[model samples]
Target: MAEDLAREEPRFPPAEADVLVPLVPARREGGAHRVRFGLAYLALAAVAGAALGTTVVVLDRPGKTAGPEWSSWQPSGDRDAHPRQIADHVSQRYRRPSGTQLVAVTYAGEPQVQQVPLSAVAIQTGGDGSDSPPKFVQIENGLMYNLCGLGPSCAFPEGELSEGGLQLLRREALELALYSFKYAGADSVIALLPPNVGNQQDPDDDTSRTLFFQKRDLARELERPLRTTLLAPEQPQPAEIDPDEGLIIDRLTQPRLFQYEIRQAQEGSAFLILAPLVGG
Candidate 1:
């Protein structure tokens, strides 16, 4: 199967990403949700945007750097960067056709752009049993989010799922969740949540159904928290606003980084055990 993916034609040019997975209800509420594994059988896999438009601010900053590994891996921070230009580039190299999902990861050398079936990651949209293919995607090992937004410059703080807002995102071992897009900003990476994961009424509300837990507990659920980011929301570039004149254009336009295209890459595996929470 891996070889088959390697042989597939390269889709859109390559691309942070955000992922939304619904936590299985402790006792079942809506209905029985079956995880789609029809990779032929492969396997798989935030918040609403209301607060996004208001004059809200993020307190956290990118202070704690994981290492040089990720410092150079994020999208370039050049002040004049335009999301459209980046999207154009990504669309050319990484975008995939129907039923196919593109995952950007580093195996041993160059960042290998592997094609996995949509069933490998997303669940059936429930409306239709057909598989919903995810657009191009790139992921990091650490938990990622925007700290604050002040005009064109948005804050993307790399942290963990220990706080109230993020703790709401925790998942069972080997379980994958999906979040719908909450807010897409010029400065912040696009926010997403499972259609049914959180409060379905609003679809973009983050404070709903929130839970808090010990930092170590979160660390335990994600055995390799820093080495893998779930595959779902595509990463955003600077100046990429969610609701704008180009809303349609941006949603379909994939994002790519000019810097990483040619450099040696160190991304983690797209499909990992994402082990169970053994202990805090």
Candidate 2:
């Protein structure tokens, strides 16, 4: 009975082959989903590269630098930073030692005068001398009176300065004026030469020679350092004068000396009266 039962159970053929069924569908390599993912990856990479490039460019760009501090003289406060103080500083710094005379070449057919250190510096602040700093912007349209002479009388001997000597004197005056304009923040500077005093009692009897400088007139020269500008070449002689040398001649060599006066008005306001001397 056991042998008959076993033969009956083994009658089915090797039980059907095992079959496997996947849970999800298979995808192709070049399918739309794969292409979309590749494009998104490339776009992200491109955006990252662009951002990095922009950062590098911004880091490499140059930036503006601050201007130089030209003078060692610093004011105690803004209230003390006035043209008069600047002038005083300049006069003290540039005062010539006793018994030293400035020498220069003599030119024919030119007036002669002696060159000396600055004696005093006066400021016309377009005010009644009460304001600490003038109410108006004097740097734009102000007058700096630089007095040059030997004594309180501020008189110079006649025929002591040749044309070249005068030119040298003018150079000195210009240097002072430049320093005043730079440190004092003035736009205009007038350097007054000592008057040819016939009488020692009255020094103002004669018209004093003058040299005027304006900031706008010296735009090119001001771009350089004060030392380089001061070391400019000597003035050319009349024979060596160039037509294009108008700046050098008008500013340094043959500056027309004008006589100026501060006339007080009836209302207490003062006005500057400028007139060209007869032979300026």
Best by TM-score: 2
Best by lDDT: 2
Candidate 2, poorest ten consecutive residues by summed lDDT: 104-113
User: For model 2, how many clashes?
Assistant: 1
Off by over 4 Å in 1: 1-66, 71-77, 97-227, 230-280
Candidate 2 lDDT over residue span 1-280, tens digit each: 3342222211223545775644767467547777987887787777767766766676676889867654435434563245555445444433222334332111111111232222222333343434443222123444455455554456555544344434445555565566655655656666667665222334345765566566776676667665445443443332333444434534452433456555444654443444444322
The Cα local distance difference test for each model comes to 0.23, 0.48
RMSD to the native, candidate 1? 35.0
TM-score of 1: 0.16
Candidate 2 wrong stretches, greater than 4 Å: 1-43, 64-141, 156-162, 179-187, 197-206, 212-256, 260-264, 270-273, 278-280
> Which ten contiguous residues of candidate 1 have the minimum total lDDT?
173-182
In angstroms, the error of model 2 at 195 is 2.4
